[model samples]
Target chain A: MSDPIEFYYDLSSPYGYIGAHLIEDVAARHEREVLWKPFMLGAVFKEEGTQPLVFYPKKGAYARHDMARTARLHGLPLNFPEKFPQLTVNAARIILWAGHQDQAERKRLSLAFYHGIFGEGHDISDKAVIRNICETHGIDWAEAEAAMADPAIKDQLKEETQAALDRGVFGAPYFIVGDEPFWGVDHLPQLEKWLESGGW
Target chain B: MSDPIEFYYDLSSPYGYIGAHLIEDVAARHEREVLWKPFMLGAVFKEEGTQPLVFYPKKGAYARHDMARTARLHGLPLNFPEKFPQLTVNAARIILWAGHQDQAERKRLSLAFYHGIFGEGHDISDKAVIRNICETHGIDWAEAEAAMADPAIKDQLKEETQAALDRGVFGAPYFIVGDEPFWGVDHLPQLEKWLESGGW
Candidate 1:
């Protein structure tokens, strides 16, 4: 393998959840590794003068419906919280903390957080929710909690967001396979073809 | 067969060029007819407080590159005009007039308009360009020019746009199969699956 497919997403992004659910499976088929990098989609939006796709006018309604339909099609459990488009900074900090431990551990905790928030309608942003989920999985609750306050970890997220924006990632579920960049879950098929053909 | 797939597009949209090229081919596979409906995507943008997707900062750069990539993927010629995102009301009026003829003629004319503006980089907004293209195909040059000034044709364009917006279309190359609406060239796969499974 040349390098892991870099996958960037935001926890608040519904499309990010779909991309997360599918990217790993697609990568597995090609015997390729995928690096799930959680970034601040909100930060990107601020710079892009855009809002979430689900917050647009007529398209907004369709986006919500599409998310539900996509979740069903993928056979993934998606119970959207009543308070959606939730703040995901805390979730990112935790994922960054996990990334410091081991790649597998990071992947494990990241997906769990995604499932808990988007899959089960749990707000992983809450410290209690994070602690409970982390404790159940034998993650160091204190370490994870303190990780968010660490300047280095905070800088990690800032750097990641800046890096993603530099790469033309204005939206979530952005993927960079080598020099080629693909954005949104919609680009997955093209990404697959690129992988299969070794760049089309 | 059920109703023909309502294929909505805007003449000035690059993605619309891709949709015009492929929708017919895709629909033919399932023995389905396509209603090529051209609407003013500009009007939709005004209502949504958004500009063309290419005008946005980071996403703009990606869109221009993607349009070229998408054209290549479809094996279609795409020569972007010097004055891009051209004012397409004249072209739309001509299309609306062609729509009054047989569906085949309408498809031919619409694709021609798409090819002229997008493929050949001709300014179809100019009457000379529209007249030259339509006259070669046995359409009366004077009649087509007069058609643009026709209140009914103008009304037809407006009605089509309003109808599309009413159906929750927010972008170019939007599709409505039965009651289901799919947006973007990216949703073509999902649209195909929906047609195959008769709605998943």
Candidate 2:
């Protein structure tokens, strides 16, 4: 057994959601566990002095179209959220809190959150929405709500984001296997090859 | 035959260089011809208020690594240019002129320029280097040199770039099949699937 594949993602990133759907399967194939680290991509973007990929001029429109097309090609359902790129800091806090309790079950909550926000076009930034997802996933809403504001959980996310920056993670769906880093969902195939061949 | 697949690229893009190696084979698989359109990506970058993928801080370093890794994964040779993102305006203009003379042979020249810059780490912005590649390919260097400076040939490059912008081409190695547009070397698979299924 080797170190778990580090999977970094942002809830607001559609590509992140798309990658989330498949990364586990790829990791499972190699008899490896995956550590899902959800961070605030907004903070990374602010630090990098760049915006979301879908906010550029001509590139934005093309990106939106490409997102839908990519989702379709992969047989995943995606509907663009009306309130896109919603503030996901609290959502990060929730995931961090859950993972602290049960590392194995946290992925289900993350998937539920991603599916709600991207797969169903729900607003993840809303607390009610987050609570609904948490409770639906068997997480106690009262405890999870309290944990969302827990200073330790908040610091966990902040420190995680800082560590991600230190690791040169500028985008969502960024993966780190061993010392090698792979960015974007598009690099999934290469990531699999690295796992199989142990780097080329 | 349907309309030829539009293949737009910049001389300095490594991904564009990698894409050039495989697009012809993919297009040929579908019995389609490729129209190689060379344009100044720097001009498009200025318009979009963005720079090359490898110009950003953290993203830049990762992109360089990814480019090398991706090329090796595809079994193609790649060595980073000494002077990257070189003044490729003249290289683009030369291609436009050569393509005007012979559309098919222009791709051969484009590959030659890409091989010199990325495959062998040569400085491609120099007129001597361009002339060497031109002469090696049996192209009339003197006429090509004169054509590079000709105002009409220059305008042809400008018009081609403007047309690319109008078509929403914001990056290198962009492809269009029918009314559908696909971006990046990663999307080549999806592009091929589109070609196979007509549409999905």
Chain B TM-score, candidates in order: 0.96, 0.97
The digit string of per-residue lDDT tens for model 2 on A1-200 reads 98678999999999999998889999889988898888889899898878998789989999899889889988999989999878988878888887876657668878899899988999988999988888788889889889888999999999999999999999989999988998988888888999999888
Question: Tens-digit lDDT track for model 1 on B1-200?
Answer: 87688999888998998988888877988888998788899999998878997789889888888888889888889898888778899888887896685678778888888888889999877878888889777788788889999999999999989998899988888988988888889999898888888886
Give every collision pair in model 1. none
User: Candidate 2 lDDT (Cα, whole model)?
Assistant: 0.89
For model 2, residues B73-174, the per-residue Cα lDDT tens digits are: 889999898787788888788888777867687799899999989999888889889888888988898898898899999999999999999999999989
Which window of ten consecutive residues has the lowest lDDT sum in model 2 chain B? B97-106
DockQ numbers for every candidate?
0.79, 0.80
